[model samples]
Target: MDKLKLYTNQNFDQLRQRQDPLADQAVEDLIANPSFIDVINSWDIIPDQLSPDFSPRVRNFLQFYFDKQSLQETSVLQNGQDFFAKNGDIYLGLLGFYSLPYCYAFGDGAEVLVRSKRIVQDIGKRLAETGVFVMDIFRPNAFISDSRAYLTCAKVRLIHAFSRYFIQKYARDWDPKFGKAINQEDMLGTNLAFSMIVLRGMIKMGRNISESDFEVVLQYWKWIGELIGVDTSFWPENSKEAFELDRLIRKRHLKSTEAGKTLIGALGGYYKGNIPDALIRQQVDGLFYFFLGKEASNALGIKSTNALSGNLVDLVFRFSGWKNYGSKKSYEGFRRMMEIQQKEQFGEVIKLNLPQVIRS
Candidate 1:
């Protein structure tokens, strides 16, 4: 066996022991890349199933996210071109939905993150040596991280999309000065349906606001999911809270889920940028439905192994928050963390506007 393939396979074994879907997805991913597989398939797959019991629907969705997306302009990451692809940002953004849930259920996401980082590093190392562009590194970690970043960027992008789509649909007069009507379909991608599902999860947790506010994004997501034949209720729908509370959290992002008065606290933060007394629960109620037996799960093409992939993210909402003055003051905190991430990767941040017109 080639040393590199051996190294990667060993890493995958440890990942399998942890029972991670993203890691499982990574192998199939590496194998899918013509070049990467060309070299590794000769090495023989040990256990065969990298992630046993992966859902066909989700596996297709995740693999499709990697295969189809890339970064869009206004991306905070300077190196955006190096990371994202068509709908890449949304794909990565959905991955972030799992962070709070995973952290609560899995304890520390560092192992997963490290494994992810390793995938990125290995892919980078491989590409760097050959100077070959294998369509977004073709590595498992890159798949997860890119997918995560895609999710985060999706939230921001969808917010931008919401701003645009909402204006076009309802308030055409309220312009943010970007330009004339944008092709919402062109801007957000078919994946926006799934992205809407994510925003829905964020909103459902608190039940603090109207689904109408973000339903445009959801509509777009539905279009995309349907294009690929996925169920519309990809997110938790039945146990959702009221709209008013959901709105409170979306505008203002509370740091922790296990706090009190989350809506009140989120409101203050939305209006003002201050952390209120909305006590962030030290422990997020991660698996209310997540940790529950399989019977309790909504199971949108998920399994015990693949559960890490957005299958349980709505649980982030289950963590209660206190709506203290301080908490409301510090809502919509997604900005700061994102800014920090850009700043940290400032050196590697690469920016370029891809021509929307792909030449034949």
Candidate 2:
């Protein structure tokens, strides 16, 4: 694993400097043809339906990006999809309790999130949109040619570019040392948060996933990483690599910052009252502490919860998770809950913040 260190510093530095050129180019095209922005904002059309009035580069990029010809329906991928289908409720819980909170521990990337008021101010909607994206990719046959999943990925990638555009143009306080807003390294880190970190959380909760299953989950997100413009060449291929990548990233960037605290606090505020038990609800910080571990929780300034509350929260999660592991009813319940949350957060339909144009 020491060999991993040899390439990490140089490669991660390069990745930190890189942004999604394709998506950024599309943003530039939009700026050059402002009318095209109106067309994309319409929220009901696909790339194929765009008229010649749109910039050729933008149209071509949209078609190429949304096309799913590059995705392979291998046995490993299908296994990954099935795994998600069986355990999606647990997966969603880990995303909320572990992966996203893990993300806020990174100081530099948290700065970008802090600058994006929509994410901090509207944490519930952001989480719902993220859940939608994850479900879209996890769905069976989602990677089939020209599927809605690709459109979702394309929309998110472009949204990143738009955030970059707006942040670079505005946000006068943005420091260069953080790299470009939503740089490749940060995106890759976020990808790992959703994939490797979620799996790790499952392990922490006494869930047993085979090594093969774990690798496939990572591979599944590698494919997703490619679709979302993350550099998959740097993506981990196995447990050892994934662990080392997380270690390296944590060593380099897992420090406290106001931005990190702000993001995590905002998230915590949004999840208030989500717990059923009144006593447990009072110790919600215990849930954060349980999944994120002491270091990350401390970094995010999560208040200490009593030992009794911490163990109780862990038991509750483990018990519920065990009961619901592969139940379709549980999956549907989670989906229904998410739909209600989305409706409450973003009108009757979950219209994502940027580039609403996707084929209905």
Candidate 3:
């Protein structure tokens, strides 16, 4: 199959350097349009339907979590930084190869993603940008104040517009079950995967996150969701609500599909090619199985367990947890390590920018 040539040839940096006023205007118009709101409202079940009241536990947790002095401090920021530092690769793999492919398996989106051929590269670029966004959002004075945040929002709008285009261009090919490529439910599900699913993955890997830090991380994504035009009405206020919503969304949308399996195979193949060491590759395979569990891994055609390597990975995580617990210096070291890794992976932390056109 010929690869789709849907995106402009210009790179994102070039696109930003030569900003087109018309493109900018189109994005602003899309964000302001009421059609998005109508689509969100059309959902059969909203967040409120799942959890109407913010439970006392959640309320109290937030009250203390967001106390003025706490916000003034950098402990929460450090914790957020430390999380990625310790589990950056694992988090990226889970989202890109595991959670995302699982989501893509739904309807024609899988067809779209798998057929693109550039999907793996696109995922890599997005993951790199996401790490930048995470660091910026959690930095003391940079949350919502930084240019990276603004650019991230712009990129999101462009992606969302591209989804709208796909839905219109291929209306006949669309599946009612999935609604559209970037439908409200799917958008919310993506957000949940980044926060709730990520948290779950961390725990599975034996990382310990404090309650306060966890809430703050969710809050950060909630703000990002709002900025990117995700309906505020469906945003979960706390982890408990997020978990419930995650479960409900998965139950409604997740099913094995051939397109999904193909996409997963493409992603796995990409990783296998890049990772030369057989032992490390085997451990990564185990990690995928561990992260997604038996059912999801099987659906994606990921191989069964490498029990020894998997257990070894778990043991390493446990040891790291034991050594790093409550140690600020340890977290600081991890943060620096993560920064170095990002620089190596992406080559000098390129600024986030809006794409001139959709590439995938």
Best by lDDT: 2
Q: Can you write out model 1's per-residue Cα lDDT over 110-174, one digit (the tens) per residue? A: 12222222223332222122111112232223323344333222222222332333344555433
lDDT of 3 by residue, 1-360 (tens): 111221122321122222223223444443445343333323322222222243443233223312322233344445555555565545544565456655654533465455444465565555556655555454434432233334345455455555455454655755544444555555666677777777776666566756765677676676666555565455666666666666665555466777778777666665665543454454555666777777777766777546534456656544443443423334345445546655776676445543343324
What is the descending lDDT order? 2, 3, 1
Weakest lDDT window of 10 consecutive positions for candidate 2 = 322-331
Alpha-carbon local distance difference test for all models: 0.29, 0.77, 0.52
Q: Rank the candidates by TM-score, best first.
A: 2, 3, 1
Error of 3 at 98 (Å): 4.6
List runs of model 3 lying over 4 Å from the truth.
1-25, 28-98, 105-112, 115-117, 120-123, 144-147, 170-172, 209-213, 276-279, 308-311, 315-351, 357-360
- Residue-level lDDT for 208 in candidate 2: 78
Candidate 2 colliding pairs: none
Error of 1 at 327 (Å): 9.4
Q: All candidates' TM-scores?
A: 0.25, 0.88, 0.64
Question: Highest TM-score among the candidates is held by which one?
Answer: 2
- Cα-based lDDT at residue 267, candidate 2: 83
Candidate 3 C-alpha error for residue 194, in Å: 0.4
The TM-score obtained by model 1 is: 0.25
